[model samples]
Target: MDALKEGWFSEINDLWPGIAVSLEVTKVLHREKSQFQDILVIDTKAHGKALVLDGIIQCTEHDEFSYQEMISFLPLCSHPNPKNVLIVGGGDGGVAREVVKHPDVEKVIQVEIDPAVMEVARTHLPFMAASLDDPKLTVNIGDGFEFMKKHRGEFDVIITDSSDPVGPAECLFQESYFALMKAALKPNGIICSQAGTAWANLDHVTKTLNHCRTVYPVTAYGIAAVPTYPTGQIGFVLGSLDPTTNFREPIKIFTEEELDKMKMKYYNDKIHRGAFTLPRFVEKALTSSHEIPQESRKEL
Candidate 1:
């Protein structure tokens, strides 16, 4: 993939075409060809430790909380009770760590396809992986799709912490995956998935949101800023079985004391509402006729 060159790691993929986000690497901590994909752990000069999968930067110690916290709390706080939550793909344990912090979340079940990612994270990224062994979490090594099929209408919330739509994670963005999640959720259940950056992949985001709208009574898209990600932004596709679901408003607003106790770094009641406020171009693209002209697909 030519990712590491001249002491720098650049994320170059056909998914985002010409643009690449590079980080200055101080040392290569670990690298391996796992059964599923290539995994690399590096200690960067500034961003601290970073987990890379298939030439893509999954998370860095510097800005991972923004993505992990927003993705987990956005759906968790929106639900009246997110007691039994299911995480589809978060091998680094960041999402699980954030989900268990919610007072309403009693139990969490995480399904990770690659065991090597978990092993690497546990060894190299202790800060994020520390909660993997929490009593409230059950770690299962298997495919999320097959797991959800057997346990139908079981969870109150399902958060998918998948990578970009490529390689092993390609199916996670498909319409069939949304259908299965809908079947796996209980009445009034909410589901959220990584929907990529609207600045670079608006068409991809729109397509996923459209797929979600087919099975969900209420659907909305939200964004978070992660500097390492393409275009310095990432978005989520959220949907709920309840018709009254409002993605813009949090059903459970945490007090300042609660936020301090939970160690929330990026999520709050106000941030939850602001995440849904899309830029003018993105708003038009998602709400307009489900067609993005090829000429308009340029990166903003």
Candidate 2:
């Protein structure tokens, strides 16, 4: 039974083998949690219900906000100033917390497809999840693709914290989805999306980066370390209308000088720039235009 558990966990998720809020066989709800694309929502510790897809946690209702914050803030901080922001995916209300951190941000809209995930998060991860209740935030639980269609050229920043590109989050990685997101941003707006890991999913990251360049003037890739994410390494795809105009200078939000106080453990000037550094293998894969093989990947 232990070995089978290891195999199930190893095959489907990037999280550490044992790091979780809680783990109990959920027999209640009289549901097996299999109808939701093999994704099971298990009640966990402070973070809330964890979405375990195919026996692996695709996302959790709790502690996901931390991942969202570092993802959103670094890019959000990169932009000299960001006002309106749009979040695609992230039904857990994590991204919304980080966006409101900056005082300059006046409006934020988060579009999520699953209502159940959002409800679990709201009831569980409260401190960071509190932003979901903010009047400044307009929470829409539905298709992100449709929402982008109506709000053209509106947002200053767009953050995509999507799940793996296999099931529900697949469309979030398509060329058309990016095109619509590009259209929904202001002229000088910036775009950033979780491109998975350079170590495990180089093909996915490279594909996203290349596709983004076709629509936006500038496309760059960066990475950060989140212990729970796949390979404990994750990358981001950033696109800007004009890369030159999208520069950052330390301001009231903690400029290069006051950044000492910020003391963000993960983000720094060097780390920010280094996240774009691709390994020889990835660089080769992107240049050669070959789909990275399944065997090369480290599973989930």
Query: Of the candidates shown, which would achieve the greatest lDDT relative to the real structure?
Result: 1
User: How many residue pairs clash in all the candidates, one count each?
Assistant: 0, 2
C-alpha TM-score for every candidate? 0.95, 0.76
The lDDT for every candidate, in the order shown, is 0.91, 0.65
Pairs with backbone N, CA or C atoms under 3 Å apart (clashes), candidate 2: 47-62, 250-255
lDDT of 1 by residue, 50-163 (tens): 999999999999999999999999999899989899999999999999999998899999999999999999999999999999999999999999999999999999999998
What C-alpha lDDT does candidate 2 achieve relative to the native structure?
0.65
lDDT of the structure predicted as candidate 1: 0.91
TM-score of 2: 0.76
Q: After superposition, how far is residue 35 of candidate 1 from its true place, in Å?
A: 0.5
| Best-performing candidate as measured by TM-score | 1
